[model samples]
Target: MTSFILFAALLIVAVIAILLPPLLRAPKPSTGADHREANLAIFRDQLAELERERENGSLALADFEQAQNELQRRLLDEVQPAASAPSETRPGRKTALALLVVLPLAAAGGYALLGNQQALDPLQRQARITPQQIEGMVAGLVEKLKENPDDSKGWLMLARSYKVLERFPQAAEAYGRAGALVDQNPELLADYAEVLSRSQGGDLQGKPTELVERALKIDPNEPQALLLAGAAASDRQQFALAADYWARLLAQIEPGSEEAKALAAAVERARAIAAQGAAAAPAGQTAVANGSAVSGEVTLSGEVAGQASPDDVLFVFARPDEGPRMPLAATRARVGDLPLRFRFDDSMALAGGKKLSDFKTVSIEARVAKAGKAQSSSGDLFGTLSGVKPGSQGLRLLIDQVQP
Candidate 1:
């Protein structure tokens, strides 16, 4: 700010220096002075003519004297008024002084009224809004929405705001109120699906999956929709479909970016799972595919069993002991079916080309979800048995730990 002010002061000084001198200097004499000088020169010429006329005997001495006297009288009359006239340059000097005072003040006043004074303040430029302020703004928006319930655009904006705040339920409600506005917009549909899934404890089944499908139909290349669709497919154990969706998403992303690298890794995993499943398809005809089926009993321990509701989902799955975490075989039930007998084989493989027979050893897990979701979350009961052979039988898997 100091530097800016110094530069502005210097510029003002330079402008004043350029303009003031011309205004302050004394002005040239007026046309009356020129007229007086012209008249004297004329008088001198006439006097010389009169002298020549008398010397040549063309005029008498008396005539020559009279003519010279007349010329001298005229010259005196012209010179007297001009000599008595007051100087006109004083007023110009006064105007220059007035301008010297007014110009800088006018410039400063105009800038104060119109310029951005806070631009030079780094703190003001970098200031961030507090969370309380954001909440207040959202509250105001909510009040406005209540008064104008038919405002679809407002509802969409409110939905996005709620999503940013991680208030999933409110975001879902706002998206629903957005009516037809969100229905045709692929991005909004994807966002709505995401928030709806989040609101339901991250289960993308049923409506959330349907919303994602709708977004994909509208714009097959929509990135978020493809991502969500891939996740939904992966959750359903359709690894081939998941791979396809992610590959499509990958095509739209810039290569060599972090996001692209992560996505590429996911696509490869899904494709590998799909390839394994495909390889196992022919072996599905056998009862155990060379004794690859693993038989087990899943039981919830008494300590965490009481914490699970009857309708909560139960997932039993096996992953390779040393490779990617994608499940090779899986089965689902409910908490009410605890202490149930379970079997996983090539037939139960979730992906087209992956099977339990492929792994020499695997890790089996059982999770009782409180929210009926496949993915474990806080308060879910789960247990893991590692280094178990695929063809192992009569294994007892206990749900002993509570996810935090």
Candidate 2:
């Protein structure tokens, strides 16, 4: 900052120096004697021209005399007494002094009004803002928005602030208020969908899914939209659609980047699932129609069995060995049903167009959910056996570990 001020001072000094000389120098004065002499010379030329006109018979003798007298009278009228000319040097000096004072002040004042004074201050530029300060600012914005509800930009800013604070419900409400502002913007739509999904316990169904789809339609390569769309398709067991969405997303990322590598891996998994589905379509259909079953016994391990309650829901499911983690087939029971026989079949598929016979190898899992939710949560007891075939029977599955 000191260096910048010094440099600016030097520039102002240079500008003043360049202008001072021109302003200070007095203008050449027109003296009375010089003016009278010039008038006499003009009178002489006029008299000579009158004589020539008379000799050429263009003027009468009386007319020639009148013309010469008129010329003399005009010269006399133009001439002034040769007196000392008033000094202009004083005015010039005053103007120079005024410029020296006013120019620097004007320049400084203009810069103070328009320039970024804090630009060179490193401390000011690098100051860290605390989370509390940010929240205060957001609160201020919210109050301002209340006073001016038509401010769409303010609403959008508030929405983003709420999202950053993980206040998802409030964020969704603010995004809704953003209204038409979010409709045309793909990034805004994607962010709105994310917040809305978070508000719904991370379920990107219904309105969130619709928003994701709308965002994708506007910009096919919108990264967040594509991610949400792919996840939604995977949740629906539409592996081919998920693969297509993820592949498009992968194409948009820079090669060799970590994000690109991760997306590429996801795309590959989705494609593997889609390929497996294609290969098993006919057999899976037939198996579902024929009611083929994979019967097994689920027994809780003595080591972890003490954690289970009699009424805790037990979920037994089968998923393909490769690709998305969605269940192909599942059955529900209670913790009291431990050491119970379970009949898993294509008929118990979790989603349409997917069946127990849809993969070469399937993994069977049994989870005792204390919260009675299908998804595994903390404190759940679970176990798994991989490489089980669709018609495998008399298999013993153990519920061994506690979900962390």
Candidate 3:
């Protein structure tokens, strides 16, 4: 709107500049100078003719003198000044005023008819795809797919496009078709798992975990597969396994890159949690107890250590690999008791059927519970280690990041 007003004002100023000179100019006065000059020249010419006639004996001297006087009188009549007259500028002023109103209106009307006002709107000027354009593109792809249903690359492209457009169900379907045609290519499998996970509210376990495992089987070092597997492990409270997967992925990427750094940090955190689980074994049970005991040391990170209270509860425990997420072996201690050593075995099981020895693998988590709750909650500082075999020892867990 501001830009529109500025352009209109500029147009008005330009019109005024073009028309002002004629409107404001003074009327020229007539002083008879041109008439006087014309009369003098005529008089001189007649006098010369009369003299020539006299010399040629074509006229009498008195007649020539009379003609000369007549010419002189006419010249004198022309040269005499006339009375002054008033100059009326009212008509010109009225015309100027009318034009001042009409020109601007005309220019504005013309611009309204020919110009695109939206062009001046910076937000509108940026090109963006509309819903209709997206629909058209999708229709085109559908038609192409109908004609070439077995084209793996086409299906892959369509799947990616659907993912970008946030049509997760369609993307998953397309990815499935592509994967089938391509014999479950590792990259496609990974992408399929990702979109499927997104469709399921980001739960990467169950089917998504299976897909990730399949991708890993095809190419164990595949970055996406490793990343997905690590995320799944972390979500399942298996920080140790997550660390292993991310560490493998980290080795494949360029060092010092943001992804590599993030993976390295995650690896360190997972290792810290694993160490804490190892320390969770009982005081006198440093040696293996039923082959499922986990022993480790738990401590807070530097950032959290200073602000943490000595009375804060630290919960360290192990959970079954595939059964319920409830802790299988657990213990609690105060923050002041850390860098406190911990030990956990089947004797600490919350339920008899959920013991660590019952599972082939287990996960360990250590949380600093400011709220003093046994169950993890928001704002609790925690770390985890996953996929530990029974009787792991000498692990270290650092309670660094907070639960969101």
Candidate 4:
């Protein structure tokens, strides 16, 4: 708008320069002294000619005199001052005013027709299609990936785009393909795990855990693994374990970082739970007995922890530090060294059985041979064998139910 106004002003000034001089000049004013001089010179020449003519007996004195007087009158008329005329106020001011108004008006018209209309129409139209355009763009990306399947980066991008579009199956396929291209990449594995976990409704894919382990091995302090581990441990009711993972993550980040603050706050919450437990020990014991066994079938179900890597089993012994360190007696069923199930009953109290009922509190510790281990989980335990009666439907934590 400002530019238009400026242009209009300049145009008006240019037009005024072209028109003003002619409009203001006196158009038909009479000639004065210079004209008179020229006229007198002509008259004198004529008189001289007449004198020569008389000397040569070509004209009579009376005729010569009449001609002379006529010429003299013409010369005098030429020499006389021009007729007096009132000079109306110069037209320059009016011309300037006209240009000032007209140019701005023209400029405004041009601005409305050219700038506003032409510039804004396209912008508004483009804005209207923005959402669809984004979706279409992602679709195009996936299509391109189909044509060039070998491009790892392209596959990764397409997978992420598919996830954004909520095409879970396609996203999983794309992520899988990308993983194949870039094997052992912790970040890629982590990203894959996130997608798989979401697509499977919180069920960690076989590959994600493997990736998590690999990532931890690659970078012991990887925040994502720590966070995932913390959440997983928390889900298993390992409050202290969760705190450990979260605290480790927070320590790695800058103290003032937002992530650091958030993780720190989470750790604090875990600590509060621990404190609450400590405070309500007697009251909690009356209700939550540690020595009892569950009566009903717990339907133990979970993937075998060491099926893929038996040497890296992370068995958690959930028991209080002050109590008999040997856990309450329990029977573990192993299918060829793969933890298949755990049986808790009266017969589980022997020296050979895993003592499951003695501890007032429980947590887990796993030996991970990988370079890095996952941090404590923030997720709550599905159930704990911590407080079971001697003959109650105690917890039968299915290995298959373990969700990380």
> Quick one: best TM-score, which candidate?
4
lDDT of 4 by residue, 1-404 (tens): 45645676787678767876666666565455467667778888998998899888889989888988988887666655433334445566677567657875786688777765544455544645455786898878877877987888888887888787777777777888885654566666666766776777776535655666566556556678767756755665556556655665665565467876787789889757755654566854534433344343323234433332433323322333454444333221112343333333322232222343544434322222122222334321123444443444424444332335
lDDT of 2: 0.80
How many clashes in each structure? 8, 0, 24, 46
In model 1, what are the clashing residue pairs, if there are any?
275-353, 276-353, 276-354, 277-352, 277-353, 277-354, 278-352, 278-353
Cα TM-score per model: 0.46, 0.42, 0.42, 0.47
Q: After superposition, how far is residue 59 of candidate 3 from its true place, in Å?
A: 4.7
lDDT of 1 by residue, 100-193 (tens): 8998898899889998989767776786888788788899999999899999999998998888889999999999999999999999999999
User: Which stretches of model 4 miss by more than 4 angstroms?
Assistant: 1-101, 117-135, 180-187, 204-206, 216-226, 248-263, 274-404
Worst 10 residues of 3 by lDDT: 81-90
Residue lDDT tens for model 3, 166-249: 989899888878856534588778888899999998999888888888787677666888799889877866665666567656
lDDT of 1 at 300: 84
Q: What is the lDDT of residue 379 in candidate 3?
A: 80
lDDT winner among the candidates? 1
lDDT-better candidate, 1 vs 4: 1
**Worst lDDT window (10 residues) for model 2?**
80-89
C-alpha lDDT of residue 395 in model 3:
83
